[model samples]
Structure formats: structure tokens, C-alpha cells
Target: MNKTDLLKSIIERLEIDLDMIQRAAQTAYETATAEENIAENKYDTLSLEASYLATGQARRMEEIRQACKAYQQLTMRDYDPERGIQISNLVQLEDAQGNQQLLFLGPEAAGLQIGTGPSKVTVITPRSPLGQQLLGKFEGDEITLVLGNGRQVQEVVSAW
Candidate 1:
């Protein structure tokens, strides 16, 4: 799949997630303030606990909303492979065994994967270990990744 197709999929997924989060957040907020959750005495903390849970849910919902907004507002730029890797670039990497993975670097939405088959794209941020290592690497460059006690080598096949 092309970048446009992958980007559309990502936005669609984010919208779905945002809707679900809003619904869940509303439910949690309502449940927390419901009469059944009211504290009966000084020792009663059920309502307080529910309120805390609701707050956390609301916070998470806000975070997801922000992420969706950031993604939607991203300007698609034409990237030159020779310019090296950067956010908004589609990169192709190959391992020693010839296994390949397509990655889309973005400012947000890290760990979000889109597409299937050979067109599958995994979203990564610069803060991630692999993303950090891939930054500034040109095509045909080999990068050594350290994972715990093992090391794996991957080559930058292409970037667009």
C-alpha cells in the first residue's frame, strides 16, 4: 500500500479509538458520580476510588484526542531518500535473513500498525529505540540493534 492509503487507515483507526474512548470516559464519569457510588461514611472510599478511575479515563481520552489531532494536522511532505530518515518518511528495512519491515515515522501514534501483507507499515516515533537508531541513516546503511543480550543487524533498504 502507498503512504496515502496507510495514512487514511491510520486516521480511520484513530477516529474509531477516539469515539470508543469518549464513550468509555463518559460512562466512567457517570458511574463515578452515580448515587450507588456515594460514600456512606468517613471510612467509605468507593466513591473516591471511582472518581480516581474516572479521572484517569478522562486523561487517557484527552491524550488519544490530542494524538488524533496531531496526526490529522500533519503535512505530507515529499521526502528524498538521500536526505536521510526523518519524521513523515516511509522507510524499508531488511534483516540479515532478508526479512523486511516497512516503518512510518511520525511525531505521535507510536506503535500503531497499518496495512497487511507486504504493504504493512508500523508507526514509530523518534523516542523509540529502533526509531532512534534509524534516524539519519541512509539507504544501504547497516544498523546494529541491541536487544538485551542479543544483537540484530538491519539494513536500510529504502526511504521515501
Candidate 2:
């Protein structure tokens, strides 16, 4: 398939995850608020107090809102090699060392890399080590990573 077809397929598949994330976020917000209001349920205090644990409950809501926004941004995206390297971006990079990978970032750890059949691409998330390496890079610029074998690999290859 062409780039347009590939991108369209990605966008279509991403909607399923985006919808689930949005629902989960919305549920968390409502549950938090409702538990805060439930004066009769003493055990429900945990939910009411969860925000204190994760920092600000209000901030959590804001974060979920932002996540939904990011999902929306991703769902509408067409493959653009010029978007620059960063989180939530599907980037391709090549370092002086020579490791290559394709990225498809979601709100969390979720995805698969299908080779051959239809979409022959290496799937990875922004949370992975490789993802972290390619998080902020430009074409031709080098990115290197150390291995458990005491060897450093500086290989990174990117496609749009």
C-alpha cells in the first residue's frame, strides 16, 4: 500500500484505542467526583482521596483532557516526515551506530508490529528504551544506546 493507504489504516485502527482512553478518562473523572460527594460511603474514601496520591485530582482531570486532545491530534494525522522528533510522534531515525525502528505512540503501552501481510512496520511506544532514544531527534543526527553486553550501539534509522 501507498503512504496514504498506510496512514489511513493507522488512523482507523487508532480510533478504537482513542475511544477507549477517552472513556476510561471520563469514567475516572466522574468516579472521583462522585466518590467525593458520597458522604454515606466510608469505604469510598479511597477514590475521593486518590488525587492526593497521584498529586492533584484536578490536575489528573486536566491530564486526561489533554490526553484526549492528543488522541484527537493523532487520529487526524497523516504521515508527515517533517513533524520533527518528539513524544506522540511516529518518527524514523538513524544514528551513527545503525539501529532502525518505527514508532506508533499511544497514551500508554499498547500496539503491535505486523511484518509483511499489510503493514510491514516495527511497532514501538514512546515508553520503550528505543522510543526514548528516538524521542527527540532529527534525520542524519546520531543517537546511541548502551547495551547490557557492554557495547554501545549508535544505529538509528527513520522513515516518515
Candidate 3:
């Protein structure tokens, strides 16, 4: 799997999500301002509820827009294994059974997953536990990951 192509795919997916979020935010704002949503009775809070919902949706839309920008600005360059792990690097990890998972170190979009088949990759941030452990690590190095009640060893098969 090509790292640059996968990064482009993730950016494209984020763009699609941003468009959907914008539409939803606009619809929510319109509904909140519609006359039908006004509080007609003493016990009613329809307008207030709608306003809150619209505000939350608008905030989410802004967040997604910013995330799109961040992803777009990412430099799709190959990482030198000698330089160690860093953001914008794609790391391939192998477990005891030889199972592999591709992870992309990103500035944001920590939980986003992109691609399919062997190209599938998950975005991780430096703040994440696994990401923290992988930073400054080199290929052929092994690290023990503690997750909840279990521990597993993962080897840095490659990074680029």
C-alpha cells in the first residue's frame, strides 16, 4: 500500500464528511429558526432545544472543516527509519502471530480509518498511548503495549 495515496484518500473522505456536516448544520439552523419550533406553551422548550442542537451541530461542522484543512496541509513524504518515528509517517507493526496493522501518525483525525485490504490504515496522534510508544522508535525494534488487563508485544516492521 502506498502511503501517499492512502493519505490522499483520507483527505478526500474528510472532505466528503465536511460537506455532509455542513448540510446538516444548515438544516438544523433553519429548523431552529423556523416558526414551528417556537415555544407555544408555558411548559414547552422546543425552540430552546432546537437552538442547542443547532449550536452543537454548527460547532461540529467547524471542527470538521478545520480537520479537513489540517489533513490537506500534511506533507506526504517518506520517513527515514534512521530519523525515527514521527508525525506523517506510516508505520507497519507486526504482532507475535505475524499479524500486521498499518498506522499513520497524524496531527489530527486520530480515530479515522482509511483504505481497505492490506492498505487499511488507522490514524493516530502523538498523545495516544500507542503513538507515544512508537515515537522515536526504529524498524526491527520491539515494544510492549499494555492495554487494559493484557499486554502484547509489537515490532516495528517498517516505517515510511
Candidate 4:
């Protein structure tokens, strides 16, 4: 898969999310400031709750904005096998059962899956457990990944 195309796809997904969050924030703000939502007594908290939701939505919007900026400013480069895997590297891993998984190491937006079926690629951040294990690993290297209560070993089939 082309890294440039993947980056563009990620940015497009983020932009959609940002738009949704913006709309939700606007609705929450309106609800919070509406006259009908005004608290009439100590027991009334609808306005307060709406205000809190609006604040949370706003914070999420800012986070997505920052993530978009980070991804936009990210420099895409080919991974040097001698130096091991690093961010922006597209890695393919295979399990003992012959199951294959494609992962794109990104600066942010972990858990975002692009595409479908066998072509699907999941984005993982350096801070993620699997991402941490994948770093500094070379092709054909066995990596032990911790999954919930179990551990699975997979080999790095390729990186580029």
C-alpha cells in the first residue's frame, strides 16, 4: 500500500470525526444555554450536565485537531532494515496459525483501521503495547505480543 495514500485516508477519516464532534458540541452548548434547561432548584442539573458534555466535546475536538496537525506535519520515510522498524513504517506480521496482520505505525490515532478484509491496516502509536514490541524489530524477528491474559508470538514478515 502507498504510505501517502494511507496518510490521506487517515486524514479524511479524522476530518469526518472532527465534523461530527463539532456538531455534537454545538448541540450540547445550545442545550446547556437554553432557557428550558435552566436549573430551577438544587435538584435540577440538566443545564449543568449539558454544560459538562459540551466541555468534554470541545476538548475532544481540540484533540482531533491536534492529531490532524500532527499527521499532516508527519514526514513519511522508508524504514531502514538495519535500523529496525520505526514510526511511519508499514509492517506485516504473521502468527503461528498463519494469520496475517498489517499495522501502520503512526504518531497518533491508535486503533484506527483503514480499509476492509485482508487489505485492512490498523494504526498503532508508539506508546501502544504492540507498537512498543514492534519497534527495533527486524523482519523475520519473533515478537511476543500481550493480548489480554494471553501472549502470542508473531514474526515480522516485512517492513517498509
Candidate of highest TM-score: 4
Native-to-model Cα distance after best TM-score fit, residue 107 in candidate 2, in Å: 3.7
lDDT for 53 in candidate 2 is 40
lDDT preference between candidates 1 and 4, better one: 4
- TM-score of candidate 4 against the unseen true structure: 0.96
Give the Cα error of residue 89 in candidate 2, in Å: 3.6
Instruction: Give the candidate number with the greatest lDDT.
Output: 4
Model 3 gets an lDDT of 0.86
Question: Which stretches of candidate 4 lie above 4 Å from their native place?
Answer: none
Minimum summed lDDT over a 10-residue window in model 3 is located at: 74-83
| Candidate 3 displacement at residue 52 in angstroms | 2.0
Query: What is every candidate's alpha-carbon RMSD to the true fold?
Result: 1.8, 6.9, 1.6, 1.0
Runs with alpha carbons beyond 4 Å of true place in candidate 2: 1-83, 93-100, 109-111, 117-119
Q: Estimate each model's TM-score.
A: 0.89, 0.42, 0.90, 0.96
Against the true structure, candidate 4 has what lDDT? 0.94
- The global Cα lDDT (0 to 1) of model 2 is 0.52
lDDT of 1: 0.84
The clash tally of candidate 1 reads 0
lDDT string for model 2 (1-160, tens) is: 2444544555555555556655665666566566445656666575655435434544544554564455556542433456546544555544444544555544443454434642365456677776776665665556556677664555334544
Please provide, for model 4 over 107-151, each residue's C-alpha lDDT reduced to its tens digit, 9 standing for 90 to 100. 998998999999899999999989999999999999997778999
Total colliding residue pairs, candidate 4: 0
